[model samples]
Target: MVQVDVFWSYALGASFASAASRQLKIKSNPFQNDYFTYTLLYLSCIFAPSGIYLLWQFPHWETMQVATCHGDLPAWLVTIFSITNITQGILGFWVSYQCIKAGRYYLAHLQWFLAYFCMFFVLVHGWDGLGWQRFLYDPTVLNNQLWEPGQHMGLTFLWSNVAFTLYVMGIFVIPFMIIPMSKWIIEGAQNSPEVRSTDIPESIQEIGITFLKLVLGCSLGGAIITSIVIYIIRLITGNLLISFIFGMSICLVSGYYFFFQEGKICYDLFKKLFLAEPATSQKEKS
Candidate 1:
């Protein structure tokens, strides 16, 4: 818990600095802007809730005892976890809002729907994992033997299954949507007459490029770190499914956005280098 708190603090500080820098126009590279935005988005999704919850309700020591004993966290911790879950939904809404402001209605709608979906899952799952009633109610009876007593039964498990299923689906689907959408936006901007016409200072552009590279490096590095952790957990427990599900759930929604989104932006820049035609005119042709 202490480590998690420290991680959140560092991420929050970095996000706050990046946002401030961008608003001040200190970084002119579109890549820097893209990197900062996605970094904030990921932090908001994963850490904002935890931070907010901690601030609101500090867990008592006794509560920690119960959690350690049962392998289930106390209500306060669950509340904090919920804060984290709900904040992700808020981040999704913010993303949709940004897309709309940028005149990307399709992307905006997509993001909005996804945000709502996330919120719904958080609500139904009770944030602490108790909302899976179906599994509790109808136990899967096999050979008149109970593999594990007091385990989830029928419809209770069904709902839990649904939640997991949605999470799994998001692992692959969200990246496909976000990666292309970010690419289109960044590449589209490069060809804009206004962006091309603006006399951006070389120093600013250099700073932006540097920042972009840093963001890209950080994102990829984070993914690698997350993968290593997952590998270690699997090796220790010999249960890959739970680890994979949890890890992928966190990664796809958080780090993957930064990686693929930045990749799209970079790809756009390369496209502009090779294709002489302006992106706006190309859009018209399409």
Candidate 2:
């Protein structure tokens, strides 16, 4: 049963990633100049259902404990975790791919790298649990030792920590990336010399609002959801401080970026929207 769950989860993750990648390559450009927006929409549609399902089907307390105990988690719990991780990776990749197609390669690559890194971590950790019963039930059992010290020092532990760190950092950094891009994209659209006098400013303002919503939705929403999950996991595992730090770091970083950088973006967006129309109208009248 455990093996079946693991296989299914891997299949789902791979299938979702492949589908999302293909969807991102479809171009409805000029009419829709924002590849990021389209990709984000697509990802939200595809993965949001899985996320919601996970949230709803969250394991009961006893099950959570059984899974977290030093041995191989139950098949059901492994399936849930696998699905969650895979969905996260897919969303991150979709966001990155959109950015790259839109020429925002730095943000795109950052998101993509994070996505793959997270995927690697999920696979390693999930698979590590296959022989977990032996390690947890009998630590002194020599032949059953799943991980060598060198592997731990070199690959397993080191990479797991690295992946976790990156995951936390990526969540923190998302708001910062979105806010500036929002401002730039809106301002560029508004200030374009080719836009008509009446349409430019309104269109820009609408885009700005849309971007603001996207920032808030992804940053705050993700932070809140992640916090709840971490808290639950901590409760089950007795790793309170680690979970607190991880959750709080996300909130603090996202809050700082939104309050400072995003505030600036909002101000600039408003200024551009207000000025653009008048400037275009003046030229037309002259």
Candidate 3:
């Protein structure tokens, strides 16, 4: 708990610094604004709720667990919190995606955000082990399993709760982050003014279409790859933890490939969407 608190404090400090830097840069050159501040702010906002919940729940985990198990909390409130918790990391990625799509930052920043989420989850699940489903299915079962002299919710459980929350948060974060980032990279690489050094620009509608195509193509490819990897891992090992680790490894590799390999598969699909017509008209072409 202390560590987490300290972490938030450090983030707050960094946010302040980023804001100051952005302000200075804006004053010097408005058009040269760096989005580092906004990105930090987005990250802080996305995680604030989870951090608050962590602090509140760490000391009251048993009570909350019992409440969740018995449906003691109001159904609507429970649903809302569940959704928010589940989408915390995703919220961060979404903010980054909006920035990237709007050309607020470099492609690398988007990749960094996606990579951060992945590493965050890797740390989380690696520490907590993979009994999360069991715990969710039956809190009482977990209680029984942990029932022993001097064995109760303590520092260890507190840490585990943190990991569990992060894992849930990461479920949507990684996949969504990649979609916008991939599209932006492909578009920027080919016809963006930054790359082409031209005055004319691509139409918004065309950009949107290309983005959608990349998103759909990447989604299909990722799903297929993930499914095959998980199936093979399951066949090789009966242990959930091993399967999970391998699955995560595969995902990380796939993410790297998609983000940096120029997304050729999706690029091809984008071209097909318009019958091989240019997705974005280059300045020279225009």
The local lDDT score (0 to 100) that residue 172 gets in candidate 1 is: 51
* Residue-wise C-alpha lDDT for candidate 3, range 93-196, written one tens digit per residue: 34434443343333313332233343333222323332122123322325434232223443444456445776786564333333333343344444433333
How does each model score on TM-score?
0.25, 0.26, 0.35
Candidate 2 clashes between residue pairs 3 or more apart in a chain or in different chains:
none
Tens digits of per-residue lDDT for model 2, 1-286: 2222233233332322222222333454312434444333433443334333332332211121123332444566555654554444444544544553454433332343233323332332223222222112221122333333222322343244333443564463344344434454445444545445554444434654643443344333443455565556677777767765675566556544763242454334333322333233457768
Clashes of each: 13, 0, 0
Candidate 3 clashing pairs? none
Give per-residue lDDT, candidate 2, residue 272. 35
Q: Which stretches of candidate 2 lie over 4 Å from their true place?
A: 1-72, 115-286
- Give residue 266's lDDT in candidate 1 (0 to 100): 33
Candidate 1 deviant stretches above 4 angstroms: 1-71, 88-167, 171-180, 183-191, 194-286
lDDT of 1 by residue, 1-286 (tens): 2113332333333323222221313233433455445545555554454344433332211121112232445566656654544344344434544543444433443343233333323222322333222123321133222223233455544454333543564565345333433443444344444344332223334433533343344433444455655566667777767766775577566643653353464334322222222333357556
**Angstrom error at residue 280, model 1:** 20
Global lDDT scores for all candidate models: 0.39, 0.38, 0.39
Looking at model 1, which ten-residue stretch has the lowest summed lDDT?
58-67
